[model samples]
Target: MTSDKSFFDFISNGLPGPELRKDADNAILPARKLAFSRFRALGLPSVKTEEWRYTNIQRFLKDSFSLAQEEGTISAEQLKLTDIPQLDSYTAVLVNGRLQPALSKLPAEGKVTISKLSDAANNTQLQLWFDKHPHLQQQPFAALNAALFADGLFIEAGVNASLDKPLHIIHIYTTTGNAFIQPRHLMVLHKSATLEIIESSVGLNETAIAFVNSVTEIVLEENAELWHYNLQISEKNSRHIYHTSTVQKADSRYHHFNFTLPSAELTRNNLSVALTGSNTETNLHGLYLATDQQHVDNHTFVDHLVPNCNSNELYKGVLLDNSNGVFTGKIHVHQDAQKTNAFQQNNNLLMSEKASINSQPQLEIYADDVKCSHGFTVGRFSEESLFYLRSRGIGEEAAKTLLVNAFAFDITDQVHIPALQDFLSEKIRKYVSGAINN
Candidate 1:
């Protein structure tokens, strides 16, 4: 365990090491410097920040954390010890913030390339993508992530190729007390390529406070298809901040699934998708379960930059105990984005009187021909349904479980992968049952 230290001092001490990179693109060095400058200018965010008004990060800054290093406390074998059972796939194991290549396995037939970001940073195409979507200036954490990401995942699929198995990437935290990690992941799909990726985060124990800051960027070219899933369940006392951004070309399809368990004390998620071309189809589905004093917040944005794009988003949450949850989703249609079809909905089930959820769903349409609608709902278990279940001789605990499961069914049902759906369903069921038992 480390002593309490200031966050500014920590990041400043760590920012001077990346300028000497040799294998990376010449532009990446300058980009890192720019990102660092942006971070220094932004500094730590206060509640005054509109995007972070509800969450207070002051406490996390006050405590000292073991920032990720090349050396890890655990080995590849240790990564297998996790909450989520392993599924059949090529797995990439990341201990702390560094990629363990010895433990990672790529897909058969060499149809895909999964390697470290440093190894691929010299690629001209990847450099172009990195330069086009450089948005590290948006927030302080994002800037820090850009400047300090230790190692990242790079996946590239050829044109007209489809992967036979999904790629499962797992990130584990093993340092005691508080351990901080910042990782970067980038995926580029050529025209008509298809791929599936799953990112899972886990910690060794509940006593330590693990802090993970990760950024994932994905690009789908014309007619490409992608299914990405993020399943995060850290220590019971941890802080996690994640950002995922996607860009879809014409006739491309992108689907994203996010499942967050209640293990962490504080968690925040940012999901953004840009419809760069017409006839693009985008779908976002998320489910978060929280209990005890946990706090989880999710922010999402969908931009219809072109006309004739369609996006569908649905998020559901079950909050129990004294936990607090926040969801803010925005759907924006540009003035030129006519004939856009977008729908956004957020629903929450407050299982405890003390539990609370703040939901905000926004829709901005500048085009007359756009069909965009956004709404949110927050309520408790239906007493009518409970009564009916009780009348059928079901126990109170069992009745509550059934009602909660029914409320969460819609979100989990949207998961296209059967095994992954079952995995998420079991996690949700455990949380629901725990809330009743506690």
Candidate 2:
């Protein structure tokens, strides 16, 4: 464990070398060393940094934390805290980022392979695509994660393979003391393969602070399609920074859904997609609801490198109490990407006078033939809408909940899974009711 002031010095002074991890493969050792060098060069971001101007990350690192001394354990009863009702899918359970096969119901082994990153060190896909996303190059936390991450899930779907149901990944973080945890994951879909994945998290440490930095890289081959949904609902003692990067090939489709609900002290999400091939389709949808003093930030980037690509993005936020929210979305169209159509919109509702939001939507188009647009709006909860609902005999609390849900319907309606959509609606209702009662 290191004191607050020594957090940076701890990593800088006692850096881990290849020999530290005897289990690391010779192939991955070079990549790890390179990543460590990159981290040293970039260091951590400060408030002065353009990308981090609104969020003060150093405040969260003031507390002392260990680098997760040992792997945490969880019983089946404890895992039930993260279960979503009516989600009939294969489940993969990870404790402290290490895959626990005994507690997981994995897909069949023929076409889909799911295993720990450490266990798959010698895998061909792992060697070829590990830490290869270009967007992560400039992110210091992501670079640090690449350098020191212990273990995480690795999935590879073969050509023409399709899962009968979605795959649910449950990430459980348990620590005896305050800890810093880094989890790394990679998913690859071969040509014409299709898959659906749902991710959720649970923190069991009631008294300790668990700061997690995780990275997931996805690759979609030609004609491949993938649906990804991330549900982040953790205890207030947890802080998280997640990076999800995807690379789409020709004619591929990538759809992503992100839902950030109450209680985490801090949550920052970095999502980026690189369309390297022509005729690719990308859809990004996000909804974040924060209460109390929680802070939530979402940063997204969509890059169109070739011609005839289309990308759409929509994000909605609801801030209550003294909570704060941030949204930054960027759509970039290269000169070679002619006939690209990209659109982005961010809308937020502040439920309390002290609540605030900072939104920046940007579009950088180099091709004259491209159609790109970005917009953002932030408004306080409409009293007129509340009064109209109350005039119809609805209670104050119920009226507020209805208005919030109605404002969020545009983003929630795009969810493809019926059960998941219902779960989100219920969660939104609960969050609104709790905030109003408080």
Candidate 3:
């Protein structure tokens, strides 16, 4: 580990000589070089940066960290702790960004292909669409991951293919020392194909800090549909930055659900979708629960490039103790995007006097006939509602839990998976009840 070193300097100077060019594949070297150059030019964001004004990321990077990919193992007992109660699906288990084939039960290889990104370097789709999304061009962290990511998953669904069961991906982070990990992935759905994917994580670092920077790029062809869910509930010693970029074609439907819960010290999510064809439907929903001194930030963008597209976005937050939260949602309609309908809303609840939130919702429209609107709201728990629940014989803790659940109902109700919905509800109740008791 490099002691008292900045993250930028550590990446630029401290890494081993061969670390930068470890991927010797001639076909990918050009892309890697371009991404490395971009990262150098953009550098790291500071407090003065417009997009990162609310979160001071430099504070988290001040500690010592190792660039080397550490080797760690997980037992069956430890792996079971990260499982959802009633999820009956094929599983893919990754530890420190490396896939464990023995621990995973991947889907059959008829029309669906799931393998390691490193092994897919010679694949045609991997060569054509990897790291080519427009939304990832300007993100520094995304560029960094593209240049030096260790290993990740690659999934491709054939045309008109459909999965009978959902796919659950469990990410377990265990490290012997302070480390920085980067995982890069790409998923492509062919025309008229459909799939559902759920991602969750767990951290098992007793005394060391583990920071993860991950990027996942998705592509949906004409008439395709995707149901994507991301659940973040790592330990207190973990920090994360995630970027999910999706491109939608004509008549495609995309539904995304994000739930960020307790214990992680810092979490930042950047989600973006670009509509490239007409008559596409996009839905984005998010719910975040932050306690203690934790910090969570969500930034999203929807680009309407073609006509007859509809997009809707809603994100809610519950902040307790001295936690902080930030939300920024943007919608852009191009001149050719006639008949576009876009709506965005962000709402937050501050349970403690010291808890705070910063929200910004924006819309930019160039088409005169389009319908676009955005809104933001921040408030406390309604005293009247609490009193009514209390008067019905419910104790204070139970009343508060019920109120929080009711507040989160809008986002959770949109989940198509009944088991996942039940798991999220139980998690919310347990966290709220424990916080109130403390």
Model 1 residue pairs with clashes:
none
Off by over 4 Å in 3: 1-6, 13-23
Q: Which ten residues in a row have the lowest lDDT in candidate 1?
A: 1-10
Deviation (Å) of 388 in candidate 2: 2.1
Candidate 1 on 1-438: residue-level lDDT in tens?
Answer: 222235667776776454636534467777777787887787677677788878877656566676645355675466655534647787888777567777777666575887788788787766777634533348678778877777778888989888778888888766665667788888899999998888888766557667778888888999999988888877676688988888899999999998888778888898888898999999998888899999999999898999999999999998999999999998889899999999999999898999999888777888999888888899988899999999999988888877877887887787767888777767776777888887
Residue by residue across 63-160, what tens digits does model 3's lDDT show?
Answer: 77887888679999989988889889889999998889899989877788888888888888878887899989998889888877888889899999
Candidate 1 lDDT (Cα, 0 to 1): 0.80
TM-score against native, each model: 0.93, 0.96, 0.96
Candidate 2: count of backbone clashes, pairs at least 3 residues apart or interchain: 0
Model 2: per-residue lDDT, tens digit, 1-438?
Answer: 223336657665434555557446557777877898898788677788788888899888878778744589887788888888898999999998989999999986889899998888888888889889899998988988887888899999999998899999999999989988889999999999999999997777899999999999999999999999999988889999999999999999999999999899999999999999999999999999999999999999999999999999999999999999999898889999999999999999998999999999877889999888888898987778878899999999888888888998988888788889888888999999999899
Give the least accurate 10-residue stretch of model 3, judged by summed lDDT: 14-23
